[model samples]
Target: MTIRRILIANRGEIAVRIVRTCQRLGIVTVLAASEADLDSQAARLADQTICIGPPKSSASYLSVDAVVGAALAAKVDAIHPGYGFLSENQRLAQACSAVGIIFIGPTEAQLDAVGDKLKARSHALAAGLPVVPGGEVDSVEDARALAEKTGWPILIKAVSGGGGRGMKLVHEPDQLAATIELAMAEAHASFGDPRVYLERYVASGRHVEVQVLGDGENVIHLGTRDCSIQRRYQKLVEEAPAPNLRDGLRADMHCAAITFAKHLEYRGLGTVELLVDCERDTFYFLEMNARIQVEHPVTEAICGLDLVAEQIAVAEGKPLRLTQDDVHLTGHAIECRINAEDWTQDFRPSPGTVSRAVFPLGEGVRVDTHIQTGARVPPFYDSLLAKLIVHGTDRTQALERLRHALAQCVISGVSTNLPMHVELMQQEEFARGGVNTAYFPWFLENRATALRDQRVAKGN
Candidate 1:
């Protein structure tokens, strides 16, 4: 079952990432893109390129039919949905299966079973994984009733959404009804499913996740990644081998993640997210991502594993080339997401032509991006411009390298969150490590206030 030709069913950095791996593995890559991305770096790097439709994602990237049709037309043997769009969509797997084309991801059943938040929760509990206290809510009234039991500051989570799209936080019991209503509406608009459930909110928890690879029966973890640095519940920065994580707690996390994967007979690469109450040394299952994560490179840099290549190997019915005993985590790696946004103005998307682009260089620094100096960042997709990853012997060295790397980066024409990332690298709390999920919002708020006060002082 050797994979020969691969069609990338997405665009941007992830597409370029997959193409790089496929090329190294001696496989031809067919890149499918909308008209807006036909000239992207990924498109130019691929062995072949297919244009599906216009700039809109629905007409191209997220259109399963269009993607599959392009793959079939290109005569590719397999399709790789890189990270977003149809990466976790079971329908895409089903579409690939119907046409006898390999989907370089999990099986449709495994995808559906784990992708459904409520069902995955029940499955995790059954598999002996520690889960946050909560239950499925059948209605707004039901959610309110659950909130009464779980206490105030509850989380309304969408059953079918990821990347923080269909989630709302209710601070008080009085806000429960409105938050539930809004969450459900946003859920439907984003995921086509309005079902939501309730969960106890961890106000100061750290976001840690385990990366695992499986071949139907056995599963092995690639250690933990800390993704607590986020904005609006969307992760912006990630680091491997979560700092200050006690060995006992990390061992338990690894064991539980593997157990859950094996219980589900999961194949290919997936991530199990957990919320750690850093002060209490306790953690609970948050959710499972049944596809490659945007932050996979952090793990790859530390573990020295090509996860994309491993995904293809597992899809081909091959056992993981490395065992638990052989697996090693060395060094500290950090990744800062560079997005096309004006961070000062509530992060409005600032997509446009990349008049100038000079990514950081030197040893231990890696940049994964589909934009070059002349590339145009399309407005129809996520705002990500590039991922700047750095690895060093220790956390201090890694932090210093990230700062230097960010300093070396240069982009123009479109406003980016570059300044924000630069400021973040200088934060005392972030440098000290073990900061919780709430840190980013607080930092942003404080930074804005400080700037305003400085402006007032100058005017006076």
Candidate 2:
């Protein structure tokens, strides 16, 4: 059966993304928004809109009752919890199923099993995938012992959280306890779950992830994306066909990801992120994001697939129309996240009315955005204003196109991370590829001139 209508249970660019696909497929869209997002493009463009609750996320976006109620009130057949917010919440998924509304993601059981990072590691290991060097530390003393055994410079991570929240990196044994406490506190405050895990932090590693689509019985990997360019653990730029991936490494990573997904009987869209140590020619399973990712457009750009449409199809119990062999990933694609933040001020949120906003339109450039000239950037949600995705036959061509697109793009009345993205693209090491995760932080310290050049370019 085809989906009649879908309720978008989140906000920002993803909401706009799903609405566009629904329109293309002739499926109606019901958008549920917080009070702050009542004026959002999703609310404006959707066939139906409902005010879930107040601007505060707890009373609105994160509130399972409000979201499910909105779905029931809209009389929609399914609910798409776009990335973030309640996307990975097992209770929310179960609630949707309880009301007979399709949850456009994996089953509650899968979510629960993978929600905890340590348990997910076991699952990956059981599926013959390589896991990281650390796991759940039973107590503070156990955490100390694990840190000593794993060596210093490890990461204290909140298993239940994403978006880089609830994480701390300790460079020495002396800092482990303090970092763990901070991580746990942040985790408890951010996700309402204080559970934390440990992992050996690779100083220089490539952040490679495989995108997979499943229909309970079968799983197919679209391709790999290199997301090494990040700040504060939040990815800023991503590209398909990860640059300089060794022969067979891509296939191995894809196979491992698919194995993990099929083992859990995963359904719908998900991404398994991994850390590839280029120097050692080895990779380790990091974590699995059990929902459509923000950078999914890059995957779609090269694979020539409509992931959102496939997601809806899978949610409706339709088989993935394409086979593993049919999923051919071609060309090179890059995506730059355009966020409403001031790069000069440590990427502080810059929320205000966009005085003048114009997107670059040209060959290979696809702008996924909900903001316009007069739209007000609300502080209640994520600062992501748009995603600028471009494709080309190769990495060089893709980079050239990205530079041109950024040149033509325009935004006003708010400082943005556009400057940082442009600079990172032009960085020599980034252009060469095969750099590790720590490259960004190192670049921030060593490349002051690049940042200056970016400011000058922005002015012109």
- TM-score of each candidate structure, all chains considered together: 0.98, 0.96
lDDT of 2 by residue, 170-189 (tens): 88777777778888999999
Model 2: per-residue Cα lDDT at residue 115: 85
Model 1, TM vs. native: 0.98
Question: Where does model 2 exceed 4 Å of error?
Answer: 449-460
Q: Which runs in model 1 stand beyond 4 Å of their true positions?
A: none
lDDT of 1 by residue, 231-264 (tens): 9889999999898888999999999999999999
Quickly count the clashes in candidate 1: 0
